[model samples]
Target: KEIKDIVPFSLLTLHNEKYNKLQQSGMSQGKMKALLHNQAIGHLLKKIAPNVPEAILIDQFAKEEVYYSYLNKESVVQTENVYFSTKAEGIHLAVAAASILARYAFIKHFDNLSKAAGFKITKGAGAKVDEAAARLIHEKGLECLPAFVKLHFANTEKAKRLVASKYRK
Candidate 1:
């Protein structure tokens, strides 16, 4: 059976507050990614109890131990069934399809966030992202950023400085 047919579509996100909290707790970025992946897998397993698929192929995002710990704690499914590879997305058709779906969902969410923020929110840690973040602060109060960006990123501080400098102008 096609993975898309057997596994229902699930989109999981870590809100900014949760993301910052985890980061503050000393969780590495890879562990955070594993946390989200575990959530999605757990959700699917609970939704289809007793009919768990034979195997799960995941593109490697974190250490295998990180995923195993999360899955063991949060999922009812067997950990032995899960396999991780550095480039599983390119090797496995199912992983590739899932990657495409995830990218599509991210783009859609980013678009909505841009609309709400009144400008295109840049991705990554580029200088342009700092400019966009500063714009976000200028247009909306700093409080609004929690909904649009990961608060723990250095860009937050950089943006604040930018906004303050603008006031001095």
Candidate 2:
């Protein structure tokens, strides 16, 4: 609904299951970011004709080493067409549109997770998120976290400490 005015030529959705699997496999955040970006580009490239010129502008992920590592692993034929810029959303309409679409997808997935958890799961690694995660741990135990969190975030430790403190009392 948020993208009613935007005509989307290509869309890619990343599921939490896939994210959890990648994180559990010991993939660093930077590399995961790069892999996901590469997958999106690869998906988009498959839709267009081979002769058509395509320029991909992504907002810089702050991990140039990982970005370049995964970018080079993408289809070599289109590697030359990929480009990255700091704050690319401000410079390119396509990037901005993609950001909006990505946000919409995130919100939709968050809503689904919340529904499954029977509670409102807040976003970010703030106090509220930590508290909610602690509550999740309290109700469902730590084993359920990978289904609900990125595991590697500092918030995971915070939430664990919170749950532990509650148990000690």
Candidate 3:
């Protein structure tokens, strides 16, 4: 049987609702949620069935920084700045699982924002966020805007003008 079918829809819905609320609260909150989710998922996976071998986990954590560097498509800055050193040295199965869970949590949060605000919010930390903010202004009223968005963005000023002009006419 499929996991979705087995798990009650109401439980899933509640989980998603809580997740979204936590995500929209603040950046720090979101980060904390992601970390917690990652740790929890990692523990759960270990509890269920351990198929992942020790060797693979060690290889993954050993190259974690390298993998993070690859993700930086725009600049080589992260490659220079970030470093990963595991004390365990053998195989970081829990850490690897946590990484996957954290990523999944982030994506789910992003998707939830897109759905709630009625547009596809792009992925990433900067440009995507700006695009999402602009889209939000276009779709939703200025009063409904999130504090995270810069009120000084050109698009935000333009949106204000458009709304004002519309009301004047």
Cα-based lDDT for every prediction: 0.78, 0.76, 0.45
Worst 10 residues of 2 by lDDT: 2-11
Displacement of the residue 128 alpha carbon in candidate 2, Å: 0.8
Q: What is the overall TM-score of model 3 with all chains considered together? A: 0.38
Cα deviation at 166, candidate 1, in Å, is: 2.4
TM-score of each: 0.82, 0.82, 0.38
Please give, for residues 1-169, the per-residue lDDT of candidate 2 as tens digits: 6563544445566565677788788866677777667776666666554745457776998555657776565543345666778989999888888888878878988998898778999997799999999989998988988888877789999999999997556
Tell me how far the alpha carbon of residue 57 in candidate 2 is from the true structure, in angstroms, after superposition. 1.2
- Per-prediction tally of clashes: 0, 0, 0
lDDT of 1 by residue, 30-113 (tens): 777776777777777778778868798879976677666654555434466788899898888878878877887788778888
RMSD (CA, angstroms), candidate 2: 2.7
Task: Write the residue-wise lDDT of candidate 3 on 1-169 in tens digits.
Answer: 2433332211111243344455556423324333443343345445444453222222234255445443344222222323345543344544544445446666776677777777776654454465566556666756556432434345455545555654444
> Can you list the residue pairs that collide in candidate 2?
none
Q: Over the full model, what C-alpha lDDT does candidate 3 score relative to the true structure?
A: 0.45
